[model samples]
Target: MSTDSVLRFITAGSVDDGKSTLIGRLLFDSQSLLADQVAALYHGKHKRTADGVPDFAQLTDGLAAEREQGITIDVAYRYFATPARKFIIADTPGHEQYTRNMVTGASTADAAIILIDATRLDYSEHTPALLPQTRRHSAILKLLGTAHIIVAVNKLDLLDYSEEKFNAIKRAYSKLASALDLHHISYVPISALNGDNIVTASAHMLWYQGQPLLRLLENLPVANRNSQLLSAPALFPVQRVARLDGSSADDFRGYQGRLEQGSLCVGDSIRIEPAGQNSTITAIYTPAGQVEQAQAGSVLTIVLADDIDISRGDSIVAADSTLQPTRNISASVCWFDSKPLNATRRYWLKHTTQTVYTRIRQVDYLLDVQSLNHRQDSDSLQLNDIGRIQLSVQKPIVATTYQANPATGAFILIDEATNHTVAAGMITSLV
Candidate 1:
């Protein structure tokens, strides 16, 4: 909960749920915007407010098409810092067709703020139905392993700041979260358009006692991946091999890559994956110079004690690590291409630094985003479709389960014909 720590989060919800406005409000109210940006907001041709207040959503809807359509079509990233913490916010499109974009934004996020439009739900009902996009986004967040979730009930000002209405919507969403098995979630009632309960407490709603959205976000704990993986076995995928002239007596041979997991120190025994060659770490080098130890997420070069045939696409893991390379894998995939997934077509599966030709062996089942159930009738995955599939690679590649280590577990399917990314997949198990 250190104030200096950086927090990466995304804003998501159904269309017109105030995703952009909430971000604008946060920036404007927190005084994060500059004088020139503030000037442009007041004079921008798209400004549509009647009371002379700048249209807050314009701050993020920067695309011409987005401004014209008044809808977020792509992932818009904004950076700002408060005295409490630094934040990187991704304002993702809420439209169902742009689900892939949302996935891209939420992939690396530590937390997600799902804005629920208060006016869209029925306050009178005991269990008001939630929006389909709401369910879809929430399910996707869970699938992507976003640890924190804040369900911000927005547009409450339109409903006279009704506490009863907020409670009803909260109850409905709580049930959905329970069904999805999403545990780390918080509830906040907000009015993004009116700037109520965004950065400061709202005088209109006194019944609630929880901290405002900004305060909650500032205090939310961010996962320290490097520290968390310190005890785990190191997994480094070589991206490059640097070697000096053969004539040089001090032959400099180093394998350069980012440490995906665990820690590596001088004298640590390491194994080359797929090759099964054992070597000891003789030296580690960063941009600054040589270092004795390198932690996870560090981009450095490692010189092994033994001369091994290591190259790009090869993994360097701890000698004692239990990871095994496999040619076949069962995974959950989110289809991103307009073309339907074809099992007969060969694809280029890009995992870490390795790219291998692969073919889909079978389609396990398509996940129904709304019901969170598996549909066995579908033979192919369509655009934005989520399905479990079995695939075989041309060669063996080392990987862990997505739940265990996302760095090695995640991969993308590239359509070899067009070279367009067709799918993003998470390895479930080795087949």
Candidate 2:
């Protein structure tokens, strides 16, 4: 597959907003479904909608529990390709309790299709009425750094494909999108059930002039990690040690990892972190063969001139431009576990490859999803709560602010005793 041909995106919205159906329609209309899969849609005890057509939502709601409950409980990923582009769709749950799943799905998305049910709104005066879940998902997307956002106004068939209703939603959501500072924001009227404005234009909605959902996604530009190279140096968070026992070289040791950002070449001076030792790149090897250089996304084995004391969590960065190791950091955190995050609690912080014990120094404030306002009096972060917190790590970690370089700036808070991931955090500043 071509590098630019693949687009990783997710579907998110309030419950019963047709997120799964939208995905099923995208797959079905694209002719990506197999004959047996199509047969199951008709044969299984699967329920059909009021229109007498098989419920396309069944395509994604694969779990028996999900089919019985008629709600997406976990993240369902589907793959499809058009003549123009290949897509990896993450169908995320829309319930309030499953907000963490949506965040996890959208973390790597190039764009997001947020489905807003048109029937729920009063289309008289161009007003946009949204559920609380909508606001929560929007807030999390902003925090997670999802760049492209397309608001898909779904269930237009229920509204008789009225242009006024679609326009009203567009106006209302455009205001909200502006408030969230989302880039490349666009609106489309679609009915996932009837296949209107999905893969092709809907005849009922001739008044609306916009590309279909699939086309818009195909045209959207993927974020270029290599573009950030000018500002940040190559960052390699060692995943494992690669040792080869061969006839010619008995002591061939290489560090293996994905080159997260920037670029690296042979003979460049690199600094290994936590210990802060300097070495030169003796060789760069890929599966095909050794190459002169590698870009941001390549995973390769790098042999250093000097065998230094390096482990899985240590980072190798350009010597001239390296992240400063620090113990205290202020970050924006999304609490996901059942346990609330309190200032007195200690957790395991996994940043890049390094795992260290960390304590919550302070809970600065909790963000109100609807208004995007910060409440200062909060002492703890509940499930799916977004808050800013101060953390004091047991050991210093080489890092940069998330905005500067995402590869080196993101981390997860894990429960030390249970080993469950409790929160996802982004470094805002070094303290």
Expressed as tens digits, the lDDT of each residue in 62-107 for candidate 2 is 7999988899989999999887888999999999888888988988
Stretches of model 2 off by over 4 angstroms after superposition:
1-4, 50-52, 122-126, 244-249
The top-ranked prediction according to lDDT is 1
lDDT at 70, model 2 = 91
Clashing pairs in 1: none
How far residue 301's Cα lies from its native spot in candidate 2, in Å, is: 2.4
RMSD of each: 1.7, 2.7
- Model 1 residue 40 lDDT? 68
**TM-score, per-candidate, Cα-based:** 0.95, 0.92
Model 1 C-alpha lDDT per residue in residues 161-227, reported as the tens digit of each score:
9999999998999999998899889999999988889999999999989999999999999878667
lDDT (0 to 1) per candidate = 0.91, 0.86
